[model samples]
Target: MMKASDLLVRCLEEEGVEYVFGLPGEELEDLLFSLRESEITFIPVRHEQGAAFMADVHGRLTGEAGVCLATLGPGATNLITGVADAHLDKSPLVAITGQGGRERLHKESHQALDIVHMFEPVVKWNSQITDAETIPESVRKAFKLAEFEKPGATHLEFPEDVADEDVTASVLPTRPRVRRPDPDRDSLTRATDLVEAAESPLVLAGNGAVRTRAARRLRQLVEHVGMPVIATYMGKGAVSDRLDASLLTLNSGPVGEAASAMDRADCVIAVGYDIAEHDPKSWNPDRDKTVIHVDHEPAEVYEHYNPDVELVADISATLDELRERLDSVEGPEWCSGLRERIVEDVSRKPDADEPFSVKRTLPYLREAMADGDVLISDVGSHKMAIARHFPSYEPNTCIISNGLASMGIAVPGGIAADLALETNVVVATGDGGFLMNAAEIETATRLDLGFTIVVFNDDDYGLISEKQVEHTGEQFGTGLTNPDFVTFAESFGIEGHRPETWTAVKSTLEDAIASDEMVLVEIPLA
Candidate 1:
């Protein structure tokens, strides 16, 4: 006979989970003890929020369901933000929370709450395990649902007493892959006809295109059709910016040449485009252009996003079919002039002499990083700067939280990216976002992971301050007095540097990446 906790661990192992990010609590003692003897390494994080953020990034990079654990009450509550982030971002994750004993549920119990109800709105699926015999089934179901098409978060709760009960249950083996259906013939023909008839067509790539093999096919279709490609923040790397067809990234506002291109395009081929990444209302206010929606799922209905034709199926397969159908059509040169204008605009560097100007600093950082290196952006004004200026050569190399648009993800996200990819990770964060998960620096040091954290130290919430100044010509409640970041990094036994010049910043970044040690760099904003 095996303990239910042991069976639970076995189920996780069978699913090929390599790591579990979490914190321990009284309700999880049995599960923790079981994990001790398993091959999966349990990462004890400083905060439950940090653990969940780590899992979120792990899922985004690997396409696996990143697993996170927590206990009841406060522990479960702390995991909420990251779980919600994963849900909105469409990152696969399975969050396990331990609960008070089942016997106490009928009466008033210490640290007992209906966590299933709490998580229902955020997750794709969620369930509470009330019987020892159900542990294997619950674990298997959670992973499957989490990693399915349109992946998002799932939850499984284990009551304390049930975890210790002996059970005769076998861990279920993972199911074999199932082939997704091909696009409907009539829909594909209609989409192809619309593209052929349009004078100017543009591709709007989003987070859904960031999956495996989808980027390559999307780039091929865009290049073959000779249409300009503009990416949402989360879709930054789907097509390499070096391509002549690439128009870099789109921002939240009405500015940029990309917005101009969107305004001129008569037809929009939205490849895996999600409204959550960037609202359709912002770009399609007039709702006059024809849209061909290509995704694993149907187009989300919005007044501004009613597609003329929906190519609903596996994204890669749909692209391949479209390419075959349009093989005879000559590539259009309609957007070539706009693409050239955008290229020229982004290539011109800002005045490097300016004090810590993000526009000037990011190009140098891009030069320092090698191809395939990972860059994680925290939410703030810097996110806007990096998304607009930073050039990514490969998919999944530049990570941004556009779905939930959450702050405090970059530091822990950098740690997880380095762990999972063994690549040098650079975290770009504003000071306000950095402090939210700054304690994860210790977690990174403890794990002996190598990554560089760059804090854009403005001593204020720069984004909000800029907005306030724009709205009312004044700012308040966003300023802060901060410690010397160099000293702060030293306190955690990591290398820290404050570079006074752009040249010095580049050299410091090169040295840190070469050394492969955890480092922190603070550059005060101009």
Candidate 2:
């Protein structure tokens, strides 16, 4: 009879898992040994949070459920932000945690917490394996639900004693992938009628629209109908920003042409749009505009987002069906100059000629990066610039941690992107966001992972400070000091540089991208 931990590893291997990012602990000793002996590579990270973030990005990019492991109590608690990020961002992730024996669970045992219960609010599903025999089904269910539509996070708690229990294990077969049911013809007809009747039917795309299949169909539909498209923060690259119809990202608001287009629109075709990324009220404040919601799942109930036509099906198939129903359509007359103005608004150089300001530096970075290469943004003021100015050509290429929008994801997310895509990854982080997981630089060096980390130093929590200045005419409590980032990178045995001028910035970025090695570039902000 095999031990339950071995059985669990076998189950993971059967699912074709390539990597499990995590930290090690005594409670997970048996499981660690089993994993060490298996074909799956276990990437030991500095913090449990780093492991979870890496898994989150991996799942978001690959569609397979990314896995992470942690010990009980504190280790499991540390995973909350990243797992919650996975849940809210709609990334598929399976988090495994080791626990004390069932005997100690009822009492206030050391390092024991009711993690499964704590995780309920964040994960789609979860369970604790009380009996070793339940491992197969429980593992299967966790992976299944994590990867299912409107995909999110799942969790499994493995009791230490159960992991040590000896038993004959049976491995459940993985279910074959299935396409979602097609949208009803009546729903399509309703959507078609709404599109035909409206004069300016703009497309408001979200993260879901950028799924590879859906992105292709979305581009096709956009061209066929000639509608201007505004992607959400997470949907930056669904339609190529180079195209005339693509209006770049939509957030709370932009002052000029983009806002005008939104206000002028009578119909909004929200494709694979998730409310978690952006509120509909920002665009449809009056709740009077007709909406055609196209996604695999029903829209989340909200007062401002009442869809006149709900086309629930596989996102790609729904777009194909909608396009086939119409011959040609026209967007608002303002669509011609929308992309140019949006680009200009985002790309104008900073005042005082600060070379490394997000607005000034983004164009250099974008010009250096290939269309398919990746850029991961951490939560900070710089992210606003990246969201607005960074032009992405492919889906999942411009990775932003929206929803929970946790800091410290850029570095780990870049690492995961490298592993998942085998492409150059550039991570953009502010001083505040970078320090949150700066220790993970060693993780990248340890794995010999290649990516670029660009740290924008403002010596304060700039985002909050700027808001404070806006409201009160002054900034406070957001100021901070920093060590030399170049030296910090060298300490991790990686190359580092600082570029003072725009020319050097571009050349340095170009060199870094071509080098394909771990490098950090520190840019000072004014």
Candidate 3:
């Protein structure tokens, strides 16, 4: 008879999970042993939260379900942020956590809590597998649910005793892959008519478009119609950056001209469009305009505004149908004007002495990296600064946590970036944001990833503080006087330095990138 813990490992192998991100614990010791013996790579992270975040990145990069493991009580709670992030961002994830025995679930045992209900609201589905015979089935079901339409995280709680119990039942049967939505021909024809009739047509692709694997087909449809396309923040890399039709790709701030251009379009085609990231009141066209939404999941299609034509089908299939029906469109100067506006916006610079001068430093950074650099921005004004100003010639080179907006995400995210690129990794993080996850610096140094980190020291949470000053006329809990991050990095067995002026910043950045050791460059804002 096999232990439930070994069965869990076997099940993971059967499901094609390549990596398990987690921190081992007493309750999960048996499972950890099983993991070590299995072929799956177990990445032990310093914090359970960081482990979950690393899994989040895996899902975003591979379009497959990310797996995370945790122990009872504190372990499960620590993963809340990352789980919630996956839920909100619609990333497929599985969280297997140890819990108090089934007998001690309601009673207070050491490290005991209502594990099932704790994650119920945030996860798509959650369950506790008390019976050894049922462990395989329950976990398999959790996986299936996580991979379902509008993918999200799923939680499964397994007790230490149950995991060590003998399995008397047979292996659980695998569920067939769920089918994608079928295209409605009538709706497709109507959408095609809308596209053909409109002169200045624009397509807005969202994160859903990227998740659905429709980027290639979306590009084909754009080329077929010869129309310009704009992307939501999470949709930044939906199409290749070097493509002619892609214009003004950034996550936030006023996309005034791009919004105006979208409004001018007689028809707006939204592909796998999820409206969570966009400002509802200001974005999109007037009520009189037509909207054709093509989404793989029907729920996402009508989550916000109702479309004139909603086609529930695979995004690529719908785009192919539209491409076959609609004639080649030539919009005189619509795309050209949008391109010019982007160029103008790129040229816009901040005034001297502004504390938030990260934007001003972008052109030099872009020139320094050229096309090979992989830039990861931490959550803050600095992220917006890089998005608005820094240029990228390739897709997926500019990494961001658009879904979670978790400050201090850059260190771990940058580590992942280094893993992917194996060279030329740069992290631009703000002073306040860096403190939130500065501990990861040690992880990078131990692994010898040696990526360059540029700390933009504004001495405050510039984004929130700036907004509060403007709106409330009072400063709150946003300001800070940072210690020497350079010394901090040096203590962790890494090289550290600070640049005093703009010229120093340029020189330091160039030198840091050239170094073989991990380098930290702290720049004082204003």
Candidate 4:
């Protein structure tokens, strides 16, 4: 009998999914058998959470789509963090989980829980497949929803009985829908007029611009119009930091001359920008300005501040049209002066003498990492520092948890890098975040994945501590007395090192890069 699990594998193969990250369980033996018979290479993970993250990175890296699988109950619950991370970041992922027979559902059966509803908000689409013939169609629909307009995760809950049932009906593969966002010509004219009239113009970009392959086009648009570029956290790498007049970072205090100039500018061009994560009050308050918002999605254009003119169009097309419309008008010299001022607002050094200063540490770490090296960062202030200061010479080099902002993503995300790509991978995490996925160190060793894990041992949860300090005048609920991380790594049969100085960090990193085994390097902070 041809089972649903076999049809699921056929559907995955049809969609060009070459790798499957997951853990096998008794409940999913039928699926495992199907996986073994298919062309898809299933990499077993020590934990389901690790499998989920591995799938996330694989999708982020290849641009195809990520796929992950897990057994029923606990395994399904463990994947929530990774699933939510993909959901928040808009990464296209297809997640599958096993369930008990439909008859056992809600009967106090073993390993039975409502996984479909559990993943509802986190996934674009979710459902339970009780009918064997529906497996192929469900798999196809899951991938379709996952790859839809704003790519995100989609899931299918496969019950045990359904996996063994013979499929009397066959469903064929189908291509997913591709969205086309065309720009409004009239909106472009209005935006171009505002740009021509303004003395100082600033371009604030967001992740939306990067999603549409508008990075190079954005740079050309900025350069051609002679406007300074400022990127949100997700938009950090949208414009090259090395490029002249590129003002990306915005720190509190006094708005540097460049940022201050833009803050006070008469015109702010938000290109494919979503101000969800940015502090817009600081950027646009007290200014009599016209905001020309260009976005592929109109909802993104007006979700925050009302735009003077909303250009609902494809980001690349709108920019191209704007270039055509503004050919005769050129920005003034004040724009160049503002860029210099904004650069001054940025902090070149650490604000305080903390043991592991992010300001000072990032530049050193960037130097140690080779060009095209992949850095997977755990969520914290440290990740923000790396995003602002670290230079990625190539695309898709820096992978962080932007969506869902999962803490322990660093380790599993790094493992995914090792599994998918042969490049050197570095996982940087705070002491607190590392503890979340610390057990995955065994997964790394067992797989013999050669990647480096750098634990920023602040001995406290610095992100939460900073928030507490700001809210209460004192830090609370932040400290964590961690065990010896080096000893823990050594116990797992992985090499471990703790560096006391910046020089030692580089030295240990060099050795780790040369090793064919996993290495844990701890950097203790005061």
Clashing pairs in 2: none
Q: TM-scores for all candidates?
A: 0.97, 0.97, 0.90, 0.90
Q: Is candidate 1 or 2 superior in lDDT?
A: 2
- For candidate 3, the TM-score is 0.90
Clashes of each: 0, 0, 0, 6
Worst lDDT window (10 residues) for model 4?
249-258
**Model 2 C-alpha lDDT per residue in residues 364-441, reported as the tens digit of each score:** 788888999999999999998788778788888998988899999999898889898877889999999999999988
Taking the tens digit of each residue's C-alpha lDDT, what string does model 1 give over 54-106? 99999999999999999999999999899999998989999999999987888
lDDT of 3 by residue, 1-526 (tens): 8888889888888777887878788889889998989998787777777767666666665566788899998999988777877777777889989876677666667878787888988899998887889877887888898877667899888898888887866556676768676688899888888888887888887777777677778878878778777777666666655567776453322365566666676777878776665643345424566778888766343334668888887777888888888887864266676667665565555444444368667755765674757787888988876665565554456666666677766776676556545558888899987887677777677667778888989899988987898999987998899888888888988888886666666677888887767999887777
> Which pairs clash (backbone N, Cα, C closer than 3 Å) in model 1?
none
lDDT of each: 0.87, 0.88, 0.75, 0.75
* Candidate 1: segments with Cα more than 4 A from true spot: 252-255, 327-332, 350-352
The TM-score between candidate 2 and the true structure equals: 0.97
Q: Write the per-residue lDDT of candidate 4 for residues 1-526, one digit (tens) a residue.
A: 4777888888889898888888888779999999999999888877888888878877766666789899889999998778887877767889999988787786887777888999998999999887787777788888888876567798888888888888866656677466566676677777888888877777887766666667778877877877766666666666765565466545421344535655666777887665554646667775467888888655443333678888876678788888766753345355556555434434343444346666466655666677667888899877776666565544466775665677878888887788778788888888888888788787777777888888888888888888888988899777879899899889988888987766776678788866767989888876
Q: Where does candidate 3 stray beyond 4 Å?
A: 168-182, 250-255, 299-304, 347-356, 369-373, 392-395, 420-424, 501-504, 507-517
* Regions of model 2 farther than 4 Å from truth: 251-256, 346-355
Task: Work out candidate 1's RMSD over C-alphas.
Answer: 1.6
Clashes of 4: 6
